[model samples]
Target: MSYRAPWWLPGGNAQTIWAAKCSRRHAGAAPRWRRDRWSTPDGDFIDVDHAVYESRADAPLLVLFHGLEGSSESQYAIAFADFASRNGLAFAVPHFRGCSGELNWAPRAYHSGDHQEIDWLLSRFASLNPARPLIAVGISLGGNALLRWAAEWGEAAARRARAVAAVCSPLDLAAGGHAIGRGFNRQVYTRMFLSTMVPKAMRKWQQFPGLFDRDAMLRARDLYEFDNLFTAPLHGFKNTEDYWARASAKPLLADIRVPALALNALNDPFVPASSLPRQTEVGHHVTLWQPAQGGHVGFPVSHGPLGLPGHVLAMPEAVGAWLLQHC
Candidate 1:
C-alpha cells in the first residue's frame, strides 16, 4: 500500500475526528445498497448490506466490516461502497450481530475476537463471487477480528481473500480499551461508545433474563466498567481483562499468511500508539501502514479541481486502488 503525508489535514486530532465531526464534507453521497441475511448455526443471523455494481456482475468482490457501533451507512463504508461501484467491483458489508438495527436471536453477541462469524461470512461469499478475486477491509473493531481470523487460519486465509486491509484496528485491545477508559478519552470516545452500548445491552438483557447485571451495567461510567459487567459475562469471559486479552489480535499478527495491511494513527484517541506492533513483530506477509496522522479511522482528504472545502477523498479510494494493483 502507498503512503501519503497528511499536509492538508493539519493535526492528528483533525484526522481522528474528521469523519464524525465534519459530516458536511461528505454531503450528497448516496450509494446504491441492498440487504441480504444469513442464518448462523447458533440460531443467530448476520445481515449483509451489498453495495452493488450491476454493470460488473462478474467483477471482483470487496467485503467490508464496520467499526464498533457503526452500520453500513457509516461514512467510510459509504465511501468504499461508492468507490467499489465506480471501479467495477462488488461491495458488501457484514454487520456484526445486533449492529444491523435488529437484535440477534441468540444471547451470545459478537466480540472483537469472534472469528467464527467472520469465517462463516467469507465462506458464504465464496459462492457469490467464485470466479473473481476477493478482498476484505475492516475498520476499528471489525479490523481486530479480521486480523485474528487470518492469523488463526494461517495459510488457509488465502481462500477468503488474497489481501486484507485493516484500518484503525485496536491490535492490542487490552491496552487500547484501558487507554480509552482514562482521562480525555474517558470523557469523549469511551462515553460515545458506552452511550450506544449500555442501552443496547439493556435491551438485550431484557430479552435474556438472568444473563447479566442490570444494576452494574446501568452504573457503568466507562467502557471498562461496562465490559467488566456486561460484555464479559454474556460472552462467557471471566472478566474485562480476560475478554480483552483473548480478543486482541496483536499476538496473532505473526501467524497471518495472507498479504495483510494494518493502519494505525500515531495520535489515535481510541488506540494508543505504544500498543502498535513493531515492523519486525508481524508476519513477513503483513504490512503495517502507520501514517503519522489518521486518527482512528480518520483519513481526511483535500483534493478537488474547483477548490472544494468539505469534500475530502475517501479512504476506500486509496485502499481499493491498492487491492486492484495487488490482486
Candidate 2:
C-alpha cells in the first residue's frame, strides 16, 4: 500500500517525503555516541547523550528529547539522528534525569514541563552554535516538556531555537491519565509505568523521610494517584488538577512563537484526541497533525530498516524537512 502523510501536513508530498527523506534505508549510516554532561542551575549534574551525524561543527543543530523511559538509544531517536545526519543536519538527544543508568539526587523524579534543564542545555548550545539554526524535537513526555517550555518562553524561545516539534504528546495530563486508564490500556500502561515508577518513589521516600507521605505512596495504585499525591506536590503544584492544568501542552499551544508542530494519533490510547489543541487556537506558529491510527508513541510502520511500525515514526523527518524549508 502507498504511504500517506497524516492529515496535519500540508499538500500531498508527505508520502514522498516520508519515503525518500525519512526512510531509515535512505537516512544512511549509523552514528557514534557521545555524552555531554553539565550541572543544572539547581546544582544537579546532568548528562545529555548525543549521537552525531555528518559535519555539525558549523551546521544547524537538532536537539531531540525522547519519550518516557527512553534515552538516546530509542529507535525514534536513532532514526531521527540518522535522518539528520543524512540531511547534513547535526543532532543531539538529552538523557532525562536518572535515565542514563544513574539515579537522580533529591527524592523527586522528572516531571512534565521541566524547562530548567532545557535552559541549561540551550545556553551551552548557544555558546557553541550562536548563529546556527536550532530545532528541538521531543517525543511523548519529553514532547510535553518541550511544548510547555516553548509556551513559557514564547518569542524568546523562538529567537533561541529555529523550530520545535513534538510527537505523540500528552497535551493534557488529566485527559491523558483518563484515556490511558481505560480498557486494556489501563492495565498495560498503568502497570508498566508503575513498575518503573514505584521504585523511584521508594527511593525518594528513603532520601527524604519527612518529605513524602509513605502511607499515601504505598496505597497508590496508578499514575494518577501517584502523580496526584507524589509528583504534583513535590513538583510545586497544588494537586493533580493543578499540575495537569499547568503542565499539559494544550494550555501552552497558543503561546508558542517559534514554528512548531504537534502530532498525535486519533487512536493513541495514551493521549485523548480531544486533548489536542486546535490549529486555529495555536495561530500560525503551530501546526497540528493527526493520523487515523497510531498507538500512543508507537508509530511503528515507516520506511525504516525494520520498517517503522507506526505513522508516528515518520514525524521526525517531516519535522526536519519543515524546519529546513522554513528556517
Candidate 3:
C-alpha cells in the first residue's frame, strides 16, 4: 500500500507532531496488555508488553522494538498492537533498558546499535514458541538496532525471525545524528529527547558514581553532546563520532540475509532523505520504501469530519501486511 499525506496535514513537521500527540487518541479499542519482565544475562531486566490473541495461538508473532525512550504505550506501538489484534496476530513490544518506567540495574544502557540485545531477545522469543513464525518490526532507534542485528548475524538472523521491518529508522547514524542536532529539529525534537534522557542519565550516574562527567552531561544541549557524554561512553564507544560511525546500519545493508523492509519518509525531520538507502545499496532480500510523504511514523489518510481527528493507521497496516507476506 502507498501513502499520501492528508490534505490538512501538510509537510513533515505537521504530520510528525500530529501523529505523536493525537494518533493514540484515535487508535480506537485499546488492546489488553500483559507485562512480562525478563532478566538479561548482564543482570539487567527489560519489560515486554504482550497482546496475544488466544484464539490464534499458532499465528505469527509480531515483535515490535520501540524507539529511543519510547515504551509499549508509544503511539506507533499502540497502533501496531491494534493492527496485530485485529489481524489475529500475537504482538509484543520490548522496552529498551531503563525505558520501562523503572531504572535498570546495569550501568550501561541501550544504544542505537545494540544488536546483541536484539539477538538475545529474538532468540528467546523464537524459542518460547518454536512453531510460530516470527516477524520483527523496529521503529526509529529500535529499527536501526534491528537492522544492525540482521546485518551482523547475516544468514543466522533468519533462524530467529522469518522477516523484519524497520520504520523511520536512522540507517545512516552520522547523517541522522547531525540532522537532528541542528535547526528547528534541535530546538524541538532534540530538546524533547534530552528532557527525559538527561534525567535518566543522572539517575544512572547516581547508581554508578563517577560513571561519567555529571556536569558535562548536564551541559548537553543537543543529542550529539548528550550522546558523547552519556550514550557513547556508557555503551562502550570511544565518543559520539565513533558511535555514529560504527552503529549505522546503512553501511552494512548489503549484509542482511533475511527478508527485510526499510521504510522511511523522505521528509522525516529526524532521518534525512539523503541518508536513506537505494535499491542497489542493499541485498536482494532487502526492500526499501521511501515514500514521499509520511513524516517519521506519520501517515494520515484523511482529515476526519464531524469533530473527529485524522488517523495514522495506513503505515502500520501496510508494514504489517508486508511482514506477514514474508512469513
**Model 3 score (lDDT):** 0.90
lDDT of 1 by residue, 1-327 (tens): 343434656666566666566633333447767899888888789999987447465678889988899889888888777777777888899899899999888886778887877788888898777887889988988999999899988878876787888888998988888888888788888888888888889888889886788887888998788878877877878999999999899998989998888888787878888999998899688888786776777777655564334443456777777767657
Error of 1 at 289 (Å): 0.8
Clashes of 3: 0
Per-residue lDDT of model 3, residues 22-101, tens digit only: 76423558777899999999888999889744646688999999998999888888889888877888999989999989
Residue pairs in collision within model 1: 25-310
| Candidate 2 C-alpha lDDT tens digits along 117-147 | 6766776777777767888888889888998
Q: Which stretches of candidate 3 lie over 4 Å from their true place?
A: 24-28, 303-308
Candidate 3, residue 69: lDDT: 90
lDDT by candidate, in order shown: 0.80, 0.73, 0.90
Better of 1 and 3 by lDDT: 3
Tell me, by TM-score, which candidate is best: 3
lDDT of 2: 0.73
Q: Please state every model's RMSD to the true fold in angstroms.
A: 2.2, 5.5, 1.4
- TM-scores for all candidates: the values are 0.93, 0.85, 0.97
